[model samples]
Target: MWLEQMLAAAGRSGAFYEGKRRAGQYFLRYELPRTEAQFALLESLDRTTLDMPADCI
Candidate 1:
């Protein structure tokens, strides 16, 4: 699944770690669904970009 892939990528980059540190929650919210654009963004995201937070990256 795409979410699984995203989570794995986040794990590798430490973005998930940072998010957990700040939010006391998972790196991503479960309720808000991803759009097609968001999936495209994920596909296009490279290593350096993946190091940033999910909101603006």
Candidate 2:
């Protein structure tokens, strides 16, 4: 469910688009935060799985 929500947000943001192929693989590209504190928070959040997936936001 979280993955689905993330994908939807990404699609809305134009960060991901439907590819020519109809397979399971979807195309996605986006800019990530570039600060130490941000990276650390991301890492910690990822480890804990407390927040939604990266694309969810």
Candidate 3:
């Protein structure tokens, strides 16, 4: 599974961060595009636009 591979890679690469969780959950969620158009729109955005303000995470 892609999620499993991603987690494994993160663990091996020391990229994993600890986060709060509820019960047995990992407290992480994935948001997938509902349609191809949404995906295309997201893909069209320039990477620079994704940078956050220095004060904001």
Instruction: Give the Å shift of residue 7 in candidate 2.
Output: 35
Best by lDDT: 1
TM-score of each: 0.22, 0.21, 0.24
| Winner by TM-score | 3
lDDT of model 2 at position 47: 55
lDDT of 3 by residue, 1-57 (tens): 444544545534332422212211332343333456777878888575568677775
Q: What is the lDDT of candidate 1?
A: 0.54
lDDT of 1 by residue, 10-37 (tens): 6454776555444533334542445666
Clashes within 3 Å, all models in order: 0, 0, 0
Sort all candidates by TM-score, best to worst. 3, 1, 2
Q: Model 3: what TM-score? A: 0.24
Model 3 residue 53 CA deviation in Å: 2.0
Least accurate 10 contiguous residues by lDDT in model 2: 20-29
List the lowest-lDDT window of 10 residues for candidate 3. 18-27
As a TM-score, model 1 comes out at 0.22
